[model samples]
Target chain A: MQYITSLITATAKPPPDNAAVFSRWFVNHSSWGVLMTVDGQGFPFGNVISSSDGGTGIPYFYLSTLYDPTGMNALKNSKSCFTLSETALGTCGQADPQFPKCAKIALSGDVLRELVSVEEDSKEAAFAEAALFANHPQLSGWPKGHNFTVFKLRLKNIFLVNKLAPARYVPIDDYFKAI
Target chain B: MQYITSLITATAKPPPDNAAVFSRWFVNHSSWGVLMTVDGQGFPFGNVISSSDGGTGIPYFYLSTLYDPTGMNALKNSKSCFTLSETALGTCGQADPQFPKCAKIALSGDVLRELVSVEEDSKEAAFAEAALFANHPQLSGWPKGHNFTVFKLRLKNIFLVNKLAPARYVPIDDYFKAI
Candidate 1:
């Protein structure tokens, strides 16, 4: 198989206000994104995690510090990218018949770490913890000594695809706008 | 963070009666079960493809025939695993609000090569091709040589999740039953 690896960059277009295209796609589909990072040996480690916003409209996620070797490696490496896609239903399983199984969106970019603080009294710390908890309700009862860290993807590129149309590449700025 | 590699090895389960769940979770969420192979130099390569039937109603996917560099490296070394998830609407952007944004699944197993064929008179082949083309209408006019090679995944483990539920890891066989 031929491997293609160039960072495609483009400005995000303001999606048509009435365009239910992306919204419809996200609904009747499962949302998954891949995280790419380098290990200590410098080998690329690609893993997937649940993506969500803290109910505040900003994309974030909650992951177990104990179960994420790749995430740890990513934090250590300090350089990582994510790839997310929205595909047609037929492509996944025999899920929905009314929907064509082919539309998708992939977002790939760098990762930045945001360390969680223990002090709930500090406004800054409380805000951060609240944000993290909003996306990860399971973390509400974490035992003491457990460490949690939040990271953000400094998005680099966004790939929007519909088997019905040509694929489009949007740069970071445009991606946020389109979002 | 710990990197755990788990396989979904069990008897095959019957295909889901409603293929909707499978299609929605897998095809629509194509980013969920991406195969991560490494190049000759140990660089990673990822692709999103669906598995074909293994004659048991269970879905399966395969590696490339030519032993692409990454596939070769992955085979020589140990196979790696990844997890997939998505963000809900209104949370990420002005996308689908009614649909749960967070959909996640975890898949693990070795990458293996399997032989597949399109019989000269096989209606299944025609149907599969038509389904593909209908979603990707542009491909309707493309030359056959440009098509991707098809393969099936011999599943070892499969896990799935929705915002309202805890993640469930189904043995390959059980996964079929759940469908």
Candidate 2:
């Protein structure tokens, strides 16, 4: 068994040029982004929301119904765009964040309620709650009346800028399979 | 003049609870965000964009017409929102970005060609260019044919979440005056 493990480790190298690997790495390291949704007025409103992927690279959010306009906007319009940067990861070094070499990403789609204990229909919701509370422990202590919701963006477009020249469109399938 | 400088520094310290100062400080320290705009499909599209603000705290951007859909989207629909997170600043320490202690800001409005060099009529454009180039030096060397345009988001709503409560609306005048 030890020999088999060593053999797999030695030969199973991930492709360095894989776009999906890069995308997941960029997002997994990032903790926050501007979550955007259309407001009632049709104006696009972006708000700061902390997100964690539990190493799955799928973004999950903790939103306050009593406070965050993003939560209000999401219930009104489910569509959203979540953005993050390598600069936020602090690995961009001296490169300007605007520099293509510094890397950035946008995940756009509908921000839907994926997890609610009241739903009682989803094991995924239970796992998500565990993942979120693990990363954002403060959520467990938030006031009960504030009515916080756990949401996830169902991404339709994955846009990433990790190098010079044009940005890359990473396929969701490839992204899920990268790791 | 030296004594006057010392007097101002000693007596004119900004209040720690000032939302404007917090907003400006957060954005000024951030290098990139999800710049959201309405795409031709009417779905809100978010793109990763690097933005820098001058000492005056107005954000300026260098965008690629060949790459960022956001730049093109901005031309079609000027209304946009620029979002930033203090977690990106690495100053949140152990505080979850959602902890309310970690400040986040959203500047919403029109992302226009107000600062393009072609607008020779604008002195503000000149300052914006200087500020962007000074802060993001890599931009100065980008290709000429890419038709990179410098743009600015004309701020309409300045929203901030810096504490464990509802969002704070920082007035444009107060945002400008929070020295």
The best candidate by TM-score is: 2
Q: What is the interface RMSD of each candidate, in Å?
A: 7.5, 1.6
Off by over 4 Å in 1: A1-48, A54-58, A79-102, A115-129, B1-32, B37-48, B52-59, B62-143, B152-179
What's the CA error at residue B135 for candidate 1, in Å?
16
What tens-digit string does per-residue lDDT give for candidate 2 at A42-98? 779887777777666678887866667888888878988888877766777898777
**TM-score (C-alpha) between model 1 and the true structure:** 0.49
True lDDT of residue A63, candidate 2: 80
Q: In candidate 1, residue A90 scores what lDDT?
A: 32
Worst 10 residues of 1 chain A by lDDT: A1-10
Write one digit per residue (lDDT tens) for candidate 1, span A40-127. 6644555555454332222344444554554577566655544444432334343222122344444444565554443422433345
Task: Give model 1's docking category.
Answer: incorrect
